[model samples]
Every structure is written in structure tokens, then in C-alpha cells.
Target: MICALTGVFPVTQARAQQAPLPEGARIVVPGHGWGHGRGMGQWGAKGLADQGKTYTQILSTYYPGTTLGARASTEDIRVLLETSSDVIASSDQPFTARWSNNSIIATSDATYRYFKETWDGTNYHGGSIHVYRGAIEAHQGGSSINSINVLTMQQYLYGVVPRESPASWPAEELKAQAVAARTYAARRKDSSRAAGSSYDICVTTSCQSYGGYGTKSSPTSSVTVLESSSTNSALDATAGKVLMYNGSPILAEYSSSTGGYTAASSLPYQKAVPDPTDSVSPHHDWTASMTVSEIEARWPSIGRLIDLTVTQRNGYGGWGGRVLQMNIIGTKGTTTLTGYGFMNAFAWPGRSNGLQGNWFTPLYWRGVLQSAPSAVTMYAGESKTISVRITNTGTASWPVGGNVHLATNSASSFATSTWISSTRPASVARNATDPTKSSVGPGQVAEFHVPLSAANMPPGNYSQRFALIADNQSVTSLAFTVGIQVLVPWVSEAPNLLTNASFEPSTYAWR
Candidate 1:
């Protein structure tokens, strides 16, 4: 197949003949949304709250068909705060600690240690000995250290609400967050991400950011005044309430932003929905620019990357869907991977960051900016022009900053004398928008006005292909074709060399 580019011959080949990706091509992937778009978008919540929507209204919008559920009175949860050898526990008020029926009392100055002989999941539950509010338990689990914070769901959320969502946000927003955090904690079952770890949920993104009872992080006491009054009030406003789907707390996953649309989940309530107010988020729309060379470096097995083809998407909003499966084609071989797998590959040495989300589209470098006339018709000596557009897709812009030309091929018979060579037509015209630009730059589209003349050719039909060239090397082989029907010049005025000069003319001339 005649692979992509401009030349003298008509590019009669099918679209499959488009050239392979330039090895050093630059690609810009414009994307929408930020995180793993499942569940509610935190920014959307803040925006809704600011618009006078109640927390219940915001929650119902995100988690469709979910209602507030009742929680057990004085429910408690365990949050993994830290991991260290020396476990320390202190409290301003005298608190009691017991392990295996052995109890000890300690006040603020004189601290006491609670050692769990075995984490039977029930032996040491809460540090609340009269007022263990300022207590953090550092226990030993199988030769490793794990500092667990045991507190009532309400108080724990008092610390978590402000940390997950900024404490300075609106009251309704914080209340929504408080309810989400509470639901997330109440429904927690297993969060064993590491060996010898025995905690219901660790205070990290894996579960959610929980700021013990005091500070933003662990190894700190639950200082009441240290907590945000705003967050505490928000928690109080939405006390003992969790999102219920089917008689249980629904998994109310949340992230910093959802771009525009929340991702769908297996859960019935976590369906993909539009988040219009999410525009308040900085990550709502984003772009990631890169080169094909870096892609090759990431997947050495693929040699040089030839192309990236997204095969399947989830079929939702913005770009129609999120990439589900794609093919990474290269010189050595082709690798098929799911959308997440492709993202994981970007974590290699060169790629600065992974793609924000699967919802992205590699955008236009150059293409048929304006289509050439569907047909061309002209008489002898008449001129018809075609526009060719090009962009800097490879190592350098057209002509390598020298001068790029939209030229004809060696065999094209339609080449006019004005052509640079029998094949080369003219410098690719200036930027489509600016006339002064002489060469196409990166991400810029330059036009070329190819003058087709019919003066020298016989009138049947003609076809020629054009391509972009710079520095004597082929910039793009993806040629465009122009077909013209050159008819004989129409007769307007004609002179006749009359034989007898209208009969009397010969006699008069002879006289």
C-alpha cells in the first residue's frame, strides 16, 4: 500500500494506507475528570452546598435512591493510626487500660501502655476508661507494631470530617462529608491490605483520611479544642446517620473531584451521574502531553510505539466514555491492555505522571482543515487551487524550521513551472489564521495553496497526489488526491483563414 504523504500521483489507496506514526511524534491527550470517578465528587458537593442545597439533597443527587439510615447508639470503630515498637498511651483524665483481664490506671503525666497478647478482635476494643478521649493504643501484633485508635463513630468522624473535606468549607458541605465518612466507616468489614495488620480500616486513602481525634494525622491525642468547631458542628448536625441502600450502609466512596461525571460502580446507588457543579474543581478538565519515544521507553518490549488505539470505552459522558481497552502498537509487537493497565504503564521512568483518568482523547495535530472541492473543473491555461494543511507532528515542525513545501511527486504530469521542482509545488502556505507564518509549528496548522493548471495537458481527466516535505525528508506520506477534468478551452471568438475570401475576396486580392 502507498503509505501516507503528498506526491504527484493520486492517492487512490484506502484510508488504511495512512503512514505509521512518526517515531518522535508529540501527542497531546486532552482529558476530563481527575480521580477514579466512582461515587460522589467532593468538589461537586461543595458547589451544591454553596448553591443552597441541603446535605440531604446533595447526597440524594449523587447516590440515587439512597436514604438516611439509623445507626446503633454509641457505635465504635478502629482506625489504624500508626505503626511503631514503643506503644504510648496518655490522657489528661485518669483512664483505664486492660489486656487479658489485667487493668492499669494512668493519668496525663504518668502514661500507661496497653499490650494486646493476641488481637482476638474483641479483647481490647475502646480506650474509653472514664474519659479515654485523648487515648491512642500502640499495640504489638505478631512482632510488628500497630497503633490503633479506638473511638466512638461520632467523635472519630469529628476528626475525619474536617480532614477529608477542608474544615473551612460551608456547613452543609461538611455535613454531607460527615455523613459520607460515617457511612464509609460504619459499613467497613475488611481492610487488611498488609500482613499481620488487624484493623477494621486504616486511616489512608484506601479507606478514607481520618485525623484521629485531634490532629490531621496520628501519634497525637484527641484534643477537643484542637478539632474544628465547624467540623464538630457538622458531625453533630448529621449525627448517627448513614446512607442506606438495601437495609445497610451504602459504600459512599468519594474523591477530591470527578471532573464532570461520576464513574459507575457495581453498587446500585453508585451509578454514573452528571455532576454539573463539579466545574468548581480544578481537575475538571486536564491535558497530558507526551511523545511517542517516552511511550517506547515505558514498554521496552514494544520497541518503538507506532500508534495508540483505544478499542473500548465505558460509554458515558464527556468523550462518549472512559477508555476500557486499548491496543499499544509498536515496531516489535502489539500489546493489548485494559484502560487501567495502560495507565499503570505510564508510571515508568520517563512519563511525568499517569493519565488523570481513562476519559481522554488524543487530539488533532493536522488533518483536512478544510476539504478540497469535491470536484475540479477548468479550461486550458486556467488555474484551480487546493489547500493542504500540516502540523509539527515529528522531531521538528515542517522544514525543520527551514521551509516546508507542499509538493508533487516525480511522476505527476500536472506540475506547473511555478513548482519548486518538477515535483515540489510551493512552500506550504502560511498559518491558516496568520498570513505571516512561513512554516507550521508544533500544534499549528499551516495551509498550502497548490495551483493546478490545465494549460499543458490534454483534456480527458487527471489526478495527482500531494504531500508535505521538509529538509528534503518526507514529513508526512499521507498524501491527498485531486482529480480534475481538463476540458478543451471553449471557443469564444474564432478567425478563419478563408479560402476564397468569401468568393469575391480572391478576385479582389488577385486584382
Candidate 2:
């Protein structure tokens, strides 16, 4: 992922080293690891192989206590090649296809053929190309559909292993990856049915990366045939082997790197283990620096972020620990987020400023509440409007509609009827220069207002308790007094010590 940075921050090292950042400036954060940090670490596997570990040893270390067994390769698997309204099905040599009308047509050595529904054909080597099982629907360009390849599990791995891991890696590592990929694909053989398609898996990273037939036209055609030959050897060597526990294939998930330690896994076979070999990976440890203002732009509801802390961690706790929960303390309130939640809060696909993995150090400024409305006094059945100005001292943006709101608390004395004309108990809007703008960026003020009333209330002081609502949840509470004074009716008469001083027609007198 790439990030764009601008503004007055120094560019030259000499200038940056000479001057300190202005007080309250945002700090830079460094991060480590990559991917989800789950299952087999490809770099870690390579490290283990370099140390002369065999394929079985590597697999045993990653997926502990699993047995290697063979399954029949007769079961065919479907792999989605591309999604288009129309697809061209071809082979290196002449092939025959069966159409939807149950008609078999033999082609005169055509490189490709267009089809809509089912079209079953064969390659020069007698391998079958099945395009019949998925939707024949088109998106975008119109009149296009997706193409699928039907082949044995073994043949699918021939294209997958090379695309996922480098073909030049040690043979033992390649074999381990081949088995892992095969097992991963085998377990999801029924996925196509659930997805209402004919193919069981896709050709993207969402599934195992697959490029069919080692051809330039393959989805991942960048890989050369020579490079694929090495991985092909690994697939042949492993044949139908898969790591099994209790007579079933394990999930067999894998990623690029695990930094120094694997993530704690719930599955007994996918346990955490030290991967010192993965140190060779460039992303094993990395640093990312962003201004506090930049981070605040993402989470404005937290207010001016004063501090960020890891409140919880998985069983693995340390420099490489996986954060289970985090708390963002701002001037307005503290926001708690889960590990995955924290990732999504900042990192989006194709966007930068996100951690590579859950492991990282955070440095930020605390958010602050700058101002609040004063206590209001109103007669019973009267209304008074109030506003509170809050400053986001933290590193997240206060979003317009969802993250910033005024919510009455349980201890609030006023009933829903006390709010002047609104149906909801509380009404909130963003503090924008133009009423139409929605968000309050970092270092900006969010002004919340509502018409408070004292209708149908006894004559006494009551605390109208409220809290700031962010991300559709309440973060903290505040309160102000609303004194609902009695409406004393009086009559003008000769001064008596406790008598009303003036009245035209008094409805009631002070008791």
C-alpha cells in the first residue's frame, strides 16, 4: 500500500534532525510483519528449508501432530478463470465441445470458442475444459460471462503452487506448499455449490492463486513456463498427499510472513511457533510514520486523541503479540476496538497509513473537550437551546452523521416530551462552516446543539445528562442543570409580608 504526505513537515534530514516538532505534533509509528499472520509463514518455511529441514519436518512444525495421507485424485475441482458475458474456450490442438442443446461439435484446431451456458471441451493432452457450471451473466461491458476450468485436484495445484510461492525456492519448501495448497483447495470443493456456481474456487488470492496451463493467456500469465516446471515437479512429487487430522484435511491457510512469531490459533494443528527463519523477509519488521492529524482524520469521533493504548492482547503478548483489543482515549471519551476492527479503522485496500499486521507501536496525541454549554434556567413548559463545542485533540476525524451525536443518558431527568418539537429524545448535527458539510477534521470543533425544554416537570433543579455518541455508540457522559422554576401568579394589593406584590387576575398564589 502507498500513502501520500504533504504540508510543512521537513524533507531534508539535516533540517528535520535540527528542529524538534512543534509541541503537540503527531509522532511517527513503526510496524512489523505482513498479511494476516496465520498458518504457515512462507518466508519462515524457506528459512526452515535452508537449515536442511525436510518437507515432512517443515509441515510437522507448522501443522503439528498431523499425518500425511493420500486421497484419490479422481474427484474433479472447478476453478474460475475470469468473469465475462462471453468467454473463449480453446486448446493447443483441435478439440470437441458439447453445447447446451446436447450437441457435440468438433472444432478444427481453433485457439478459442465463444459460449454462453455449458461448453465442455478437451485440450491437446485430452485434459477437459468445463465452462458449464457458473452463471452466464455479464457485468460492465455487457454480454460477457465468467469462464471456469474443470480438472482433477492434482492438475489445479500444477498452476497454483508456482503462482503462490516462488518457483526457485528449495524443493522441500515447494513440496510443502504444494500439499498445503492442495489441501486448501480440496476442503473448499463444495464452495461452488454454496455460491450457486459450477466452480469450487476462484483464481485470485481470495482462493489459492491459480494460472491454468502455464500459458501467457492465463490469469497470472507473468510466470514463465520454466519457472512453473520447478513447482510442477513439487506437485508431482507430492501427488495426492495432504496433511490430515482425524481423517480430514486441515484448513491449511498460509501467508507471506509472521515477523518473528506465529499468531495464536484456536485449531490445535495451527498453534503458534517461533519462526526465526522469517527474519530474512524485508517486511518481517517495518516502520510507518504518520502525523497525529492524519490518524485523527480517520476517527474524528474519538475527539482530539490524547492517547492510544493496547487494552488487550491474545495469548501471545510481547513485541510481536497480536492485539485483541485497543482503547483510543480522546478528550470526549475512550473508544475501544477489537484487533480486526482497529485494522479496518485505518487501513483500507489500496490505501496507506495502516499497519501491515496487528503488531505495532502507536504514538498519538490525546483528544480534548474544549467547551460546553452553561447551566440553563427555564420556567415549566418553556424551552431553551444549548450548544457544546468539543475539540478533537486526537488523531482521528469526527465523522459527520454517525460518529458525532448528542445522546441523553439513563440518569437524564428530562423525559422525551421535554425536547421541544423533536420526536427523538435528542437531535445532533455536525459543526460545519457550511451547514451542508458533514465532518469535523482533526484540530476542529464539533458543536452539538438541541432545544431543551422543561414542560410537564415539577419546579426543581434537574440535571440533563448526556454523552457524546461516536461510531453509533455512546462514549462518555456530561450533564448540566435545568432549573424549572415555578410560575408564581400574583395580585397587586397592600403590601403584606408574604402576599403577591402585583396581579391583574391571579390564577394561583405562592403557598
Top candidate when judged by lDDT against the true structure: 1
Candidate 2, residue 329: Cα displacement in angstroms equals 3.2
What's the TM-score of each model vs. the native?
A: 0.64, 0.57
- Candidate 2 local distance difference test against the native: 0.63
How many backbone clashes can be found in candidate 2?
33
Error of 2 at 320 (Å): 6.9
| Number of the top TM-score candidate | 1
lDDT of 1: 0.67
lDDT of 1 by residue, 7-100 (tens): 1112111122123565555666767776688877899999999999999999998889899997863777777876767665555555666552
Q: Which segments of model 1 are wrong by more than 4 Å?
A: 1-20, 84-134, 189-197, 214-226, 344-354, 364-447, 450-511
